[model samples]
Target: MFKMKSKSTLLLMLLGAVVGSLGVTSASAEKARIVNTGKHVDNLIHKVDIRNLSYFDTRFDYSSKPYKMSQNRYQTYKLKRSLKIANMNKHKEVILPKGSVVTGLNDGKGNITYISNPSLSLKNQKLVFKTLGNWHGSLPIIKNNGGAQQPYTRNTAFSYKSSAMLPFLSVKSNKPFYDAEGLSLPFVSISADSQLIYHTKGSKYKPTRYAKIKKFKLTHSAITYYLAKPVKGVATKKVRSGKTHLYRATFKMGHVFQMMFADNDTDGYSLTVNNGRQEFFISLYQLGWKYVGSIVGLTGADAVSPTDAKIATDYVQGLY
Candidate 1:
């Protein structure tokens, strides 16, 4: 009886060992699969045109080869940080948790007017789309130096309003990076009560360059504003025929964007007008990466400040 029991015990132990081995192998395979997925995505990045992709969405920030870039906004644009909301009307303002999938309901120019979550909305049957972002412009510092294998390149967001619009691409940094000298970089914010009124609805430079305003809208302090009809036209060198019309959106405020395509050249704007009340022309020249020069507000040139001129003149940096 003792010998028979020992034989049975031996058989059972051998079976258990085999089963454990199989389980271990299965776990190893799953880990290998995950690793391969990261590699597969990283490999595809090398073969595509980077410009067509939104900077934060597709582009990787790598300074060397054997690029390690998979955890970017490659899949979807998610909130890196939580945005708080205190809705006075609905009494249902909740902090949007990190990693909320941002749905598309924008001004077609990356200006997210609102984000809708029906589950979060109550009382009002309509899905209350609290604004996902207010364009707070930014200034970023690149880790640039000689002898570095890969110096950081220009990768700013397409929109002028950024949490950082440096180089006008979508890259975010919570804290300013320090140079080799350990000096903290400075930040620039042209935040002002500014406005811009221009139209890009006309896709052609036809017999008469005209666009009935419809594409863009400005939201300031929870109040949205649209461009009124053009009351009069003005002459400017920015346009070829000098037929810049002042579409009626009076902005004593600062810079605001007029929408454009990814590869379209900037359109011109007439001076800021107030139905013959006030006329000011502001012009800004983007000399280079971090240099914006001049703000001329006059009768025929429409701009409130230097930042307004910079944004109104060159809002489409083409990073989208």
Candidate 2:
């Protein structure tokens, strides 16, 4: 997405995903669309209404180790030694005592944990600064200090629902495209939703003008994805390769639920759990949006346990 003009700009980050991340993949310049079109191929769809109470069942505890939980959404974790901390929102750094107990919620992107300090007078004062990368790999939040903003905050802490979501929906659209040589191309596409996803390399795209987008449907579950209205997406920039239909949408469950798309990127509809902040990008002439809508749809915008990740993965994998 060309430094989207709105929300300041939704800087695009290709997930380098599982099935569909904002990451890029290599492929022949040739472009083509599958003969079959419409209704997203039902054969690839494994139907199980996410609405079923069964889907929420943490059916499998993938971990043998004990994981802590909170009376609410916040879970418990311990620091073996004193750890340096900062408040992303306030830019004030603090140090937690050795053996400091932190309580909070996470969605992988913005894993915010805080020590209940009796000394701190302000309620918001307890906010702890922890980036996804610091805790693990290149996990991400929003732009500089956007802080952890929970969407369900207005009512009972984002409903204790968030995402470690996306993917699982699968990219099943038959994108008809032509390379500079005017050749039809085939790339890796993963079917996560209504029966399919089609891709040759499992990433990125260089788009033709939005000359004509055949009418197709965005299938996959976004069940109560915010427990309400789907986050409205923003049509970002119009790139040089003839307008990569770049767009973004966000809602909070407990964590940030941000979804990005580049009809030109073939990365399909990938996502990232941030601090309810949106800023990502896909290089020009690379990536594609196969339109996977919402996969596991969790975003764990407050991604806490691998448990949430597992549940989403299992359901998408048809285990649910």
Candidate 3:
């Protein structure tokens, strides 16, 4: 009976040890699964290293070359004394630090001094200065014997001419004049008494050689002339014989006018008219009739007239 009881106790002890081992193995498996899942989620959502990206290709190349000492006649130097007692009577040799710049040197021996302008980091245990030209780590001294030249006087009388008609016509005129093309005709003239009188240049019976068929004026700006009408007749016809029409009527500032094309597509044109203002631009656009689309404003330096603006737009669209 005693032997059987001892046998039963030993069996129970062995079973407990086996159960504990299996529990430890299950816990380890669970911990490993959690660790692997965390790593996979981090890799899927987070950026590991930005520097490893393919877009970054530029790198700084550190040079390993030594600095050269200046050989100027009036350069500064430091003395190197002899350590041996027998060589104490000999003259001490002068030495200069690496990358020492000789700015202003004196002739006397006691006044010798060296100036070093080194960067934040040193190279080869020596002072390193910023350099230009080749990256071979050589600093070449350049001397300018000739002093700075005197500034040339500018011509104050010279004035820039704008390509716009308004800028050209706004200048003070001594007398009434006509444009070379005869398209710009002075319709009305004011005398010293401020009385308005009809101009003979655009008269129906006695028209000028290049008489304009239509004229445009700023309605809100006290009747200031803007641009002449565009010609529509055949290209072979003469200037006087070609038919001209007013494409844009007299409208106020910021008023857009639509021009219909043969393909049913239309373009818009508007003038930003302002009194006593030297700067102005014409806005053009490609859109449907009565619908304002994307507009591009052309400056006076670009186009001065409706015809010029149309030609510019056509050229940009590769129509030319």
Candidate 4:
């Protein structure tokens, strides 16, 4: 019996070593640093949703009145890229198949992974696209040697969530797109609860404007807000030919939560253990936001649901 037990233990040890080696090899293999190639489509979207436990719903209809843009006389430049980073500690790169579709994923060093693919796999819930490029921008943050302005410091301050507004379709601007002051399209406002939330891409309109989000902090749990002053020139110019949209925007929101009581203004990605897994996230892509893919280190219940991924991919791809 002792001999048999010893042999079994030895076998288990060998198996463990082999598994460990494979895991390490996988990590290194993924580190070759493949990036996004912007040959395909580049786009952005605004995903809005309140934190919930059940599912990601995108259909957002704020019944008051349709939000419109305030006419302004300024240069409006659209973004050339959109990115999202899912903080994951693993080897697997959120693989996107090859095609015309644009993709986004997150990995180490806060890198945005984009895979431009043509055909998606209905069988697998993976984003189908070719391995494109990686993007990095400079923005202020609350971290060490970051931005000095902690705008969301007050408990009542609004949290800016993640959203990218890519003009999917554009019409010729025979006439200048203007508003009241002729300020060149000033702000993008969304109406909610009879209140208007205003945002701009940049302060002064430039030919090409890139608003890099250095840091996002939230305060209170009532309502979050996103504001930016983007340029106005691009909105007047012709978008990409053949392509429907020219620019892409990205939005992300972060806050600290505890118990059923939520605290909006906090610092960093905080995990609250007091409550039953408090969830705080911003959705702007669609009315019924759906999960498509995920990074590693996710536990049970958090496992990537392939069924939902296929449905969303099919639905979005059909639109293009």
Q: Whole-model lDDT, candidate 4? A: 0.21
Candidate 4 per-residue lDDT over residues 60-93, each given as its tens digit: 2223244211111010111222222111221223
* Model 2 C-alpha lDDT per residue in residues 1-320, reported as the tens digit of each score: 31111111111222121111122123233242322112332222224322221122122223435432221112233434445554324344555544333333334343433322211111212233132111101222322221233322211111112221222122222332221111233221111111111122222222111111111222232221211111122112232233433222232112112122233323222221121343212111111111112322323222224544443444444522
Which has the higher TM-score value, candidate number 1 or candidate number 4?
4
Model 3 over residues 1-320: C-alpha lDDT tens digits? Answer: 01112322442353221000001111111111001113322232122121111111111111323321121211112223211111111222222333322221222233322111110112211222122211111111212211111111221111101001121111111111121111222232211111222223322112111213233342222233222332221011123324643332221122223222333222122222222332121222211101112123333322235533343333333311
Clashing pairs in 3: none
For candidate 3, give the lDDT of residue 64. Answer: 25
Q: What TM-score fits each model?
A: 0.17, 0.24, 0.16, 0.18
Model 1 segments beyond 4 Å from truth? 1-65, 68-126, 129-320
Winning model by lDDT:
2
Across 1-320, the per-residue lDDT of candidate 1 in tens digits comes to: 01112322442353221000001111111111000113332223222222222222222113435433222111112444444443313244445544433321222233322332221212211222333221111111111211112111322221222211111111111221111011121211110112111211111101122223222333221111222233232112121213543333322222222112232212121111111233222111111111111222233232245543353224323321
Best by TM-score: 2
